[model samples]
Target: MGQLMGFLNIEKKNQKERDPRKRIGDWNEYREAMPEKEVREQAARCMDCGTPYCQIGTVLNKGTSGCPIHNLIPEWNDLVYRGLWREAYDRLAKTNNFPEFTSKACPAPCEGSCTAGFVSDPVSIKSIERSIIDRAFAEGWVVPKPPLRRTDKKIAVIGSGPAGMACADQLNKIGHNVTVFERSDRAGGLLMYGIPSMKIEKDVVDRRVHLLEAEGVVFKTGVDIGKDITEEEIRKDFDAVVLCTGAGKHRDVSIEGRDLEGISPAMEYLTASNRHLLYGEPLKPDFDAKGKRVIVIGGGDTGEDCVATAIRQGCKSVVQFGKHGRLPENRSESNPWPENPHVFSVDYAYEEAEELFGTDPREYYVETKKFTGDASGHVRSLLTGSFKSEAEEEKKWDADLVLIAIGFQGAEDRLFEDFGIEKDPSGRVIQADDRSYQTSSEGVFAAGDARRGATLIVWAIEEGRKAAAAVDLYLDRKLSLLQN
Candidate 1:
């Protein structure tokens, strides 16, 4: 370690977030980078623990407890402390295909499992990671690294989400002629649409996609793989195919008033907002939350995003319902240290709501019974009852617009049916082997949410990297060449 006693001397310093009052006025990332000197000081807090649990990538209590991609966190942290910025970036790039995405979007299970966190605050791993990658970008250290020679092998990656992007990027590195097909107008599927610009600017995703193009990866947007292009056509053109379409079948809140005019799924609302920002497409009058009282169902990451988006769109008021009660402020005996903490902490969106509305928008222990609509068939109010209380606890809240941000079940069935792909009973693509990401059909593979159900972006990247390796081996064996 650069500073043996740095943990005791220096307090945990996190990147400063922009003032909520000012940040919510526009759609931009709210986080401000910490100064380089302070980032080094935070990095110096990494301990010399023999078993660094932060990078162990283990699952505890049915939840991820550390970096699922097995990032070399300690090595990079030490390098940062030594002022070896480039070295830190190199070590980080070796394990993570896209640190820029994870640093912003991930919940940072790695910090929860940090050994130093057992007693005191954890090392600011996410901040250090963001610093390293952002510095590299500013220095022009991140550039196209095309393979030396072409393998003359063709590969098609369906979907341009994180998993598909990671898979396509890796395959391209190994000299395979890779093409990514996206149904949307943009190359990045969820990153470009589902996530608001306030979280990750669209240009950041565009920069990486452009770099991939420079490295000889082909991206075809507005081309539906299973619709405009058939499965037979893809198989005929490419030597292999990897399905990364993601879990798009959103779980619906099929209550009595689901068909009301003012109700829509989270993705539909988010996609509309993204399109409005990127293009000149105006938000639909009904979907627009401006001056409307909004109710978001399901308190998860998607719900938080809805809250943030609604605030930015000038909603009259926003309230999110969490079916489950609030989490504990500290871990209980059942959930010990080194596990992903379920402790309560305010997210960026909730903080913004607190600043703008003078109160948190989350209401726990609330379950929706049905929705009521006005004479025009537009939703007017929501009917709800307490989760654990008596029937007398039923309440009604006025709402002009409602967004169902519950969750996703699996990938859309149209693609699977078009490809004749086999799926598990739970609707996940059935891989031939747990270790091998190959699907039932030859020369076809599955990874990310399509195979594992909806998960974190970090997990999608990890699965994509692993799937690329599997595809590389399959191609090498067929060509009688050593694997890259």
Candidate 2:
């Protein structure tokens, strides 16, 4: 702790966000920079706790907390505190392959469990991470450094989402030739498509992709293993195969008017915006919420993103429904210090809606029953419900566009059938031990979302690293096959 008493002494500071009124006119990112000096001062606030629970990254006792990747939080915190910006960046890159993504997108379970946060505000760990990584990139510190040795072995990874990218990057780092296959036109999967530029800029993703390409990872776009190329082809050519296909199959309300026009899943809506950025494609006509009274059902991160997107698109009004009750502002008696806190949070989308709509747009304790469409079958309104429990129900609301943000089922099943891979009953995830990350099929392994279902980007990176190690071992044991 360079400053020793810095947690108690310095006031907490975060980056400045864009002016709500002006930012809604376009899709640029909302956050502004904290001055470099101020960022260092904030970094000085980490307590460097002897036992940092922040890195534990999970919830326990219905309230477990800790970093899943077990990031070297304290080391980087000290490095930043000492004004070792480049050194801090190096320390960060040692564990996280893409701090820029997680710094912007993660929910920050690390902060919830921060030791200083028990009584005072937690150190802005995410902000510090972003600063270090951004500085590194500007300084040419981020470059292509290929592995020292080539295995003469190759791997095929399906899905260009975080999990697949993580697997491919790690495998390439360890001297294995890696080819990433993506069903979409571009390679980044969701980050390249599902997330809008307002949340994560497209150039940032492209820069990393460019770096990975320079580092010997091969990317093949517009290629679906089950369709364009057969699973048998992949099995025969590659030394090993890894599945990172995401759980992108949407979960719909499946009500009476679901098939009607103007009722859509959140991914469809967001993907349209991303595709436009990537290729300048015409917008997905079905999803424009402009000048309409929009209702988003489901109050998770996706719903918040929708509220923000709608506001930017000039929606007349927008409201989101939360089936769960509002969380408390602070931890309850049961939730003590150094734990992952799950109190209430107001994200960018909610704040943007508040600026335009004159109130928080979330309607808690509400549910949607069905869609009410006009005779021509475009959605005229939503058949709604208000429920405190399973037995209670109330219905109807006037809405022009209804976006269902209810989350996902699992990975698209075609990859499993194509690869003849096995999955657990929940449709989540193929079962694999933490160390090996292997699938039931021989010479095929799974990682990230395909192995663990939906999860954080940081976890996906860690899993990729572990799988790289496992693949290394798998290759060493089968050198005869590699000679072919």
lDDT of all predictions: 0.91, 0.81
TM-score of 1: 0.97
Model 1: residue 27 alpha-carbon error in angstroms: 0.4
Per-residue lDDT over 254-290 for candidate 2, one digit per residue giving the tens place of the 0 to 100 score: 6788888887899899888667656778765467877
Model 1 lDDT tens row, 22-65: 99999999999999999999999998578889998878998888
TM-scores of all predicted structures = 0.97, 0.96
Best by TM-score: 1
Model 1: residues >4 Å from true position, as ranges?
390-392, 480-484
Clashes of 2: 13
